[model samples]
Target: MTMTFIIVYVVIALILVGLVNLFMSKRKRKMKTQRTEQTLSENDTSHQSYQSKFNIRDTDETSEANDANAISEENGKLNISNNSDETEALTSDQNAVTQHEESHTQEEEINEKLKQKHSAFMFGKGTSQGKVLIAMIFGMFIAILNQTLLNVALPKINTDFNISANTGQWLMTGFMLVNGILIPISAFLFNKYSYRKLFLVAMTLFTLGSLVCGISGSFTIMMVGRVLQAIGAGILMPLGTNVFMTIFPPEKRGAAMGTLGIAMILAPAIGPTLSGYIVENYHWNIMFYGMFIIGLISLAIAYIWFRVYQVTTNPKADIPGIIFSTIGFGSLLYGFSEAGNNSWTAPSVVITLLLGVVFIVAFVIRELTMRVPMLNLEVLKYSGFTLTTIINMIVTMSLFGGMILLPLYLQNLRGFTPLQSGLLLLPGALIMGFMGPIAGRLLDTIGIKPLALIGTGIMTYATWELTKLNMNTTYSHLMVIYIIRSFGMSFIMMPIMTAGMNSLPQRLISHGNALSNTLRQLAGSIGTALLVTVMSTQTTQYVSTYSQDLDKTNPFIKDRLQEMAQAMGGEQMATQKILEFVQKLASINGVNSAFLVATALSALAFILSLFLRGKEHYISKE
Candidate 1:
């Protein structure tokens, strides 16, 4: 039934495209004919005027020659007419015609300018570039949203599948690992294939993945679906970004990318909140089913809307590069991911991390030497792209890594409902969504440094505020800070990314996009791991310290315990309650410690912002 529906949908889509294309062709032909006729009429008038002037001159010369011939015949004397005035008039006529043509050309140039302005006003109406982005953003939105949605649904999924926490986490970890692996490969895919084919293939995989997940009865099948979704999503983002860079010029790129940033930030921000509501009321599969339906819609829109921006070309594959990238990024991401659950120093984590570093080094060396690299390292030679990429990684870590801390504090420590926890983030997400375009405009006007500094400053302040969170911290307080933080974020991400990408030459855009994404992915994973490690390690220390400090023999603790025991059923129950309280205190302390680290990261980004500028001009690509 699904296959049949898809086939029918495609048939309908093709018919619709045929009609639209027909209309577009007719409109274009009519416009072309009008321009041609107008040009011909102008040319004919100019030609006739020139011909008439020459004819007048010729007639005078002819009459004069006839008279001269008669004189010569009658008296054997020769005569000639100078006719300088006629010659001057003919020269003047030629100048007038040239000026008329120049003026007409100017008018046409002005008309073209007007058309461009009108197109800009319409936000790329009657343009395939706009339609492509519009369609792709939907897929990007759902794919990124899928990343966070499962975070909220994991508890329910765990119960349904009868899995352990570590086991359930693989659903998230596996998705990240797969996504990280595919991102590097996507740049190669982009260079070798047209945008249309890649978009259709990516959306198909994503939509199919959603279907698999929606119907999965076990964890193994669910993992398969998640991996499929990851592969599709991983390609969609960099591809969309590269297409944007290809179509929009530098001046317009900031605003255009900023527009895309809405989907980039908003989708993940609202995912958990939306997922929370669904998980609270519906079955876990509903989330996947919802994705499946939306994915189909997005796929259809993409099919109808996308244009072929780049034609397929053969690029020599680097097998060594591929192997190194897969092992390096995959192992590194897995290491960071597991570092959160297991300690950083665990044998497996240590081994994988070391292996990742070694392979990544080899990969970099391979790319640097290769004539046709799998992932180009030449983009890094531009100081502007290099700097922005570093700052981007830092900002991503501080921004996304810090995001997880709130949910942990709200839901686990404070016992807030998942919906309530998600709602806490809703206001912030909405703020970023609203401000993305505004910041884009700001980026174009004020420049990259100003926005970067201002954003970092606000983010630093907001993250500093999070360190003050405690058992009694008000929910409103958290929401307010997150909103402010979101505002700061709106200015930081897109502008910085655009500046970096814009710094690269046209040929290197794909490489720059891929490398930037690869690093950002690593940073997010590492940041999350680092922050979680700090929390876990600190919590354990705090628990031990609290236990040691609250000695049973101490008069102070003894008095408190007696009063609690007298009020409660027994001393043992009071002791248990005290232990639980101590554990909560330790956990909050650990959370605060994590926030402090995040604050420092944000501050470091702020300091780095001082050095940030707009895209640098390329001396040469080689």
Candidate 2:
């Protein structure tokens, strides 16, 4: 009965969000259209006057050329009479020629004007571009929210399906792998199809995938649903970014991208907590039902209001480039994800990593030589873009490290329930969401460098504080630190990304957005794997050392063991209780060691932030 109530509550919440989003979108569109029409009406007289003047100048030039030709034909014989047959014939010929030229020129002008109008309509120059952007944000919000929503439910899924941890992990690994494969191709899709068409297809896939997952009766069916959902998610992120970049100019992009960050960052931030609550109270499949309903609403909204904001072009796909990228990025993501579960030295891990590197190198070479590359490598020529991408990757690595490690520390060692751990992190996510737009506005007005320095400094300090956490650390204390870290992250993420993309040319914006999204995904996987491996290795060593000390027969160790036994109510339970306590201590020690590594990563990002140039540098270059 409780589970039914929770499901109904979640469904109601999704319906409310969807209805509110749709109403706001329609209202904004109406206002924008009215404003654009008024502005165009106000400029109508001046626009006509300018065109008339241009037409007069063209006519004068044409007349002068006709007169010169007449003089040449007469050849010094001045025919001044008005009624002569030859003069009449010459006048008639000139009139006919002038009429033909004027007709052709007028037709050309009309065609040019029509083309401009079409472009304006497609790009939302004076219409409801904001509405389109909002709709896209809403659609992307649903897609990204789905990415991490199932994470907390994975354990429940495993128990229900009776699968091993390794097998269950494919739910995440498969999603990411499909995402990696599809993101690179989005640039081509953006060029090849209208925005409305692409958006509809993406949302349709997402809605269908969610429905499949919600009703699935087998693990195989569930995996299929996840893959379908990944295909949609992979496109939605880059698609929304490309649209955002298309509508906003570079100077204003910081704030615009910041608004986009609300969906990008907040969705993932809230996912775990939201998922935990639902999974703890209800069945795992209920989460999918909620997603399916939300996705259906998002798709309907998109179909109704999403305008084509960019013109489509005819660009053929580079088959070779696609193959290399699939092998390269796909292998790398898989290898890192595996490293968290399998030893780094395992044959599968080593072979996949080596193959990934080799293919990536080959892909780079092929892109450089291709006339039309799948992923634009030429964007790397801009030093600002290059630097910003590197910094973004490093920061993403550090962020993912904390996200994965904190849960382990809280749940495994501290014995917190999944819902409790999720709730602990919820406040930080809320803070980050609130700060996103504010940071973006600051980025546009104040600049990225100062914000980045201040943000990274706070983040580094917060990460360092986390390293001091032990078994006795208070929950409130951890929450405070996480909140500070989230605040810092809000300033650094979107602003830095906006600054990098600002350095690129208009023609390369799609490619630039695609590349940034792809690499950030890779960095998250790699960072999580690297930190998890470090923690595992360190925990093993710590446990071995503690076990050896316990065997020494020292008085302190013996007394402590006996005390734990007594607490468990008998000497018979002493060995088991003592070993469990020691193992918990070792886990805490290992997590601390891993956080130290995270602190180092945060410090590195801070140092790199110092090198980041201001927005003025990019503006001046432009």
Candidate 3:
């Protein structure tokens, strides 16, 4: 059909535009690098530049006696007694210049020492933040990987458990439900306990969960394991972020978040591919076994590394806030997760969704009225946090849309093996891992607006290209587009999130992190439901149109039927084949439609990102 050609033309149209946008992003990074060099050069030539980075104040009492010669030169040119001491004055000026250079060198040395001392790795080489960050990244990577690894193994799990798809899905839904409940509660936990204690609890729970899942024989037992994993994982992510915010200065947080983003990007990227291999060859339970062992290692490292950087305050527990948060977020996420399998209008779906909204409203009111809120609703008052949150939610939905659709297109319609399908995403994932830290540094140097703008711009163009998917679309084409999409995403998620956190005062970072993660979690589920709904809705229309054309009245159908009939040996076989082809085409059309919706969302995110204030908007760190 002529519709198949639409995909080709769309790809062609987008390639040049995508290239142009990517080139502009590259140019911006270069420009930012050059500015950094120029600033360094200026700092070397002038003492005034030291005021900002090194805090060189003019207060005489605070001045270093070792550097007094440099200051004396500036105090009316050393007050030389006419021509009698002209030679002496010249010598004094030379001495003053040397002292200035030495003072600058000393400042640089102190900065370098601080940088090394705070580094994130430890073989006894770094301090609390760096060691803890490394351990958290390791633990978080495995936790995220465990989720994706389970996705690839779910079908196998269903067969083994002799359960229906709906029953099997409980494994994932349960994990998410626990995560949602725990995430909001994390802010309260952070307020009440030291991070060292939280890290121990989180890692212990996760490692234990992995062991339970690996060894459990019954479905009920496995569900228990999943809940444990969720409890551990839910706390780990937000707690890791909160610790980073506490330990690192505001100016450096972009890079720190970016460093954390490496695990975030790589785990999901590598998981499916790795899981596909393991699932294809080995028993499914082996994954949990591996996760269990790795979890123990992570647990041990995190325990040794995480430190209590600050004392915890005991905020009075908001028991009512706790109930509302759990009920509201849990019900809402559950409803969204179910909507794709059972239509949105299903009675159960509608009831839960309505309940979720009502409870969420009640929860918000309770938080607002409370003296010390459980989740800190007041963080939304900052315009920067609010704007980025909306944009983050939108982009997250679009991201989940792409992530879901591409694999379905690859393995279902295209009939690629799971390994092949996952490997296609690996390149993009690896690239994103590489770019994560770079994007963060750029965010620090150039700010969030540029990174967000360029990221969303590329995402918009790339997703727009995916809307052209058809039965005839090539595997390579899908992979290329997906890679471009991943590249754009690396620049967006962590940087935008860090920008939102930076908007809040120091005390509220944990709450902001909690809210951001919780909503994004909700957004991911809602996006999955909505995009899948769009696909199925479009599939129905296309199927109807296609079914109508399958009648003998259509000449194109006549020719196709005749060709298939001669090749396959019977009219019945030919008709059946055509019907199969029609269904496949209709499904492919649905995927394209989903991507189109994603493209529009990306465009809207780009527009909203344009309004996100840069690093200049950040509250100064305490």
Error of 1 at 375 (Å): 0.9
TM-score for all models, in order of appearance: 0.80, 0.83, 0.79
Better of 2 and 3 by lDDT: 3
Q: Residue 256 lDDT in model 2?
A: 84
Q: What would the per-residue lDDT of candidate 2 be over residues 292-396, giving only the tens digit for each residue?
A: 898888877776678665434556657667777777787788888888878899877787789889988998999888888877878888877888889889889
lDDT by residue (tens digit), candidate 3, 64-137: 44455565566558664456456665776577567667777987886676444432222333445677778879
Clashes of 2: 0
In angstroms, give how far residue 507 of model 2 lies from its true place.
0.5
Q: Cα RMSD for candidate 3?
A: 15.2
| Regions of candidate 3 where Cα sits further than 4 Å from its true position | 1-126
Q: Using TM-score as the measure, which candidate wins?
A: 2
Evaluate all candidate structures by whole-model CA lDDT and list the values in order: 0.80, 0.80, 0.80
Tell me the tens digit of each residue's lDDT in model 1 across 1-622: 2223223322432343234335434544565566557656766775676668667756766676686557546543444444774586468557756755775676567656644442221223345667877887888899889998998899889999999887788788777777777788677777655666677878888899999999999998997798778878888889878888878877778888888898899998888888999988989899999999999999888767775443334565566787788778878888888888788888778877997899899999998898888888988888888988999999989877788888999998999998899888988888888888788777767778889899999999999999988889999888999999888888898889988887888778889999999999999988999999999999999999999999999999999999999999799999999999999999999999999999999999999988875433312233
Off by over 4 Å in 1: 1-127, 614-622
Stretches of model 2 off by over 4 angstroms after superposition: 1-127, 562-572, 620-622
